[model samples]
Target: MNTRLLAVAALSALLLGGCTDTSPGGQAVRARHEHFEELGKAMKEIDGQLKADTPTSATVRVAADKIAELAPRVKTWFPAGSGPQDGKRTDAKAEVWTRNADFGTAATRLEAAAVALKAAVEGGDAAMVRAAVKNVGAACKNCHDAFKTD
Candidate 1:
């Protein structure tokens, strides 16, 4: 009877995990997670195209826009001011919570860089694309430097 009850409880949890609470914040975080995945995929595709000299500027623009959309969502994944935590599901360092404002600023700057990248690619301006990509990279590196470990 105890073993059966335990099995039933485990199954229940599996089903429950599929359904988020759907609160505004929950919705937001879900959106952010999905969008971030999309954005990362787009960036890799765009970078590959660029490096290969076969980029479709229009495609790059679309991808960059998608990434821009995800940039603001970066803050939703971490617990702000909650101290560094370690677990199976987090990519964030405790510094994200310890230095919440700085983390937020880094996220915001990434968004701005994405927007710039979108414009640059859409305009088919190589110089602008390079600059924007560099800016975006700097933002990523800065955030990683402050809040992540290998």
Candidate 2:
């Protein structure tokens, strides 16, 4: 009788643990957060190169290419039901879903800015690179203001 009760308790614990496991939305949140961290790292790499006494064009090019590659996928990161509604810890605000059109426009703006940055790098103009970086920062800020939580 004691052995049977212990087995039943162990089974119940496993079932309860499964119920509390990360939901699909939680997984999405984690994945998107990771991608965004990569994006931030790439942007920071570019910024570091720019701040150097002699900016390495190669470093800037690699970082710019990464941003361009990641920007367009920003929209897919914030799918419906992936926000705080999932009971997951996320910086994404409810406005991301409620004001989705504006979010989309912001995402597009970031993508365009990234593309412009890539083009500027290809042009081999330091001034153009600076300007493009500014545009990318502006696009990120715009989206954060409207769609992200503090």
Candidate 3:
């Protein structure tokens, strides 16, 4: 009876593990997607604060700092094999690899925009914050347009 139970547990573990993505690049794709989602959340938080009648400086600062922290790491998210060609579930376009230079430029632009955003937040000028947010959004859009499927 104990032998049978052990066999069943082993089979169950194998089945469950098979149900998940065990591809070579799957983990990298998932991790990059998660990072992008976090960046999106920070962007939304900034937007929410902007929409508020009296925008919260602390909230903006926190969100802007998050962008600053994440932007520099954006390039590392897409390793060579972590794309659609590797059969990983990702929305990153083929151009990311094919046009690597352009993608790098876009990533650098986002990093610069994020740094500007952090500076703007520190400056505590509403107009500068708004402009920095606009620049950051534009940088994101540029990359998404060139390198993302959706």
TM-score of every model versus the real structure:
0.69, 0.83, 0.84
- Tens digit per residue, CA lDDT, model 1, 1-150: 699999998777656632543544344445545665786688787788779774547677777877787787777766432222432223456777777899888888888888888788878877778778778878878887887665
Which candidate comes out best when scored by lDDT?
3
- Steric clash count of candidate 3: 0
What lDDT score is found at residue 82 in candidate 3?
A: 79
- Pairs clashing within candidate 2: none
How would you encode candidate 2's per-residue C-alpha lDDT over 1-150 as one tens digit per residue?
Answer: 699999998777666632443767767787888899988998888888888833338988998899999999999998776787755567999888888899999999999999999999999888889889989989989999888888
Give the true-structure RMSD of model 2: 5.3
Q: Which digits, one per residue and each the tens of the lDDT, describe model 3 over residues 1-150? A: 699999998777666642366555667787887899999999999999998833447988998889999999999988877788765567899789999999999999999999999998888788888999999999999999999996
Misplaced by over 4 Å in model 2 are 1-21, 53-56
Q: Choose the strongest candidate by TM-score.
A: 3
lDDT, ranked from best to worst: 3, 2, 1
Clashing pairs in 3: none
C-alpha lDDT values of all predictions: 0.69, 0.85, 0.86
| Candidate 1: worst-modelled 10 consecutive residues by lDDT | 80-89
Q: TM-score of model 3 relative to the true fold?
A: 0.84
Worst ten in a row by lDDT for model 2? 13-22
